[model samples]
Target: MKSSMATPVTVSDITENPHKYQFKQINDMTGQSILNSFDAVFISNSVAFNGGLNVLKDSIYHETINKDMRYNINIIKTAKKNENNKELKKLVKLFHSKEIQEYVGKKFDHKKVEVKKQVSYLK
Candidate 1:
């Protein structure tokens, strides 16, 4: 009952029926970060594994939400001035390639994704 679902705001908002909150015991749900909140990424048991971490039956869960609180995000970015940079373009293409997407899915438990870039430099 101590996950994000039971945070002050959630509990206060649903005082009468707070028990209805899905994660109230041995929760793998996420909560606020120690130093970051806005746009912060919190991975739940369901996010990093198939069928949620509940069935992992591995000690990895000990390092997950219920035990530790650490989160990180990687944002790939290119400056506007690099619009026509061939090397950067190639790198981005490689990143969104099917092979890389599959690697990401296997390692991160995320779905395949593609990025399409449209150039309007003439505008």
Candidate 2:
């Protein structure tokens, strides 16, 4: 029973049935407001990049809802458009850059694509 409740907690239901902790439904979920009022928050991992982690000093721990589940970010270019658009090339280059790739990978969970090795690494 404990394990079942621990695994998947209906966050919405918590409001309906409160324990010792009092709840405050604030429209603004900024770190400052959260720290001043709320005990905890359920937010995206992306929040770590947007100064959220910095603000939530001690309240930094979080649990992933789905470890195996992953959302892929597909950058699909629009119809034909232009074959040699300098701006477009620059944009693509910026997105592909190591710094940008690293930032995105860390913040947005969009990993940089790696080339396959010629030699098989099978054990």
Candidate 3:
């Protein structure tokens, strides 16, 4: 005669029942706690340029780890558009100037941030 009892195979076998398993989403508090525990984070140049990193304070240090990343500022207008709005033209020109490029590079401590002249709105 055979025994009626069965041996347990593994933890997975004990928890494999769908009715006994549950999944929960991570809340904001838990998410923030995880972020706070990290020593460093990699963020895009645009975020740093916009002063997003200031929130991290001096406890965390950051550098532009990726030099190839680029951000573009585009001015969109109708296809038949002409330079009728002087102020808009001036703003576009100012954005493409070397002065503005130098300012952005210095502001973010990133040498790669510069006006992409080939794809300039003026072109």
Candidate 4:
């Protein structure tokens, strides 16, 4: 005999009727946001570190830390035949006296490009 007051729960019941039990929805939107934010920060930091590292690796830094100006100076130092290249000459002299070796060698030194933050909402 079947009781009219009893509820019949089948496999389909759980999927179709959510009100009969506690329903759980695993939405990854929040997780995706956190992951995206983390990835952005990691990528930005990586780029910044690489930029700073390249500058440090390529330039002669005995005192002050400088970036791409080293290439100009190198060009000036090497271009002895062309006396009329005054534009190049001036840029070399502009950054000639600066030496920034130790700054680049520092452990914590990095050129940060961007930063990211995470937020969440509850409903």
The number of the candidate with the highest lDDT is 2
Question: Whole-model lDDT, candidate 4?
Answer: 0.34
Error of 3 at 74 (Å): 6.2
On TM-score, the stronger of 2 and 4 is 2
Tens digit of per-residue lDDT, candidate 2, span 7-63 = 553434464443666555443336444654555655443343354453234346643
> Each model's C-alpha lDDT?
0.44, 0.46, 0.45, 0.34
Per residue, candidate 1 scores C-alpha lDDT tens digits across 22-99 of 422222244322213433233444443443333234223334222123222223568899978999889988987889
Model 4 per-residue lDDT tens digits across residues 1-123: 122225532334454554454433322334323433432221123343444433334333322323322221222234557656878767655543234333433443533111111111110
Model 1, position 104, has a per-residue lDDT of 75
Indicate which candidate wins on TM-score.
1
What TM-score would each prediction reach against the true structure?
Answer: 0.36, 0.33, 0.33, 0.19
**How much is the lDDT of residue 11 in candidate 2?**
36
Tens digits of per-residue lDDT for model 3 on 1-123? Answer: 122125423333444456654433333334333545554433433444353344234324544323222133333443446657787778777877889878866765553434444434333
Error of 4 at 97 (Å): 3.2
Number of colliding residue pairs in each model: 1, 0, 0, 8
Model 1 lDDT, residue 55, Cα: 21
* lDDT, residue 19, candidate 4: 48
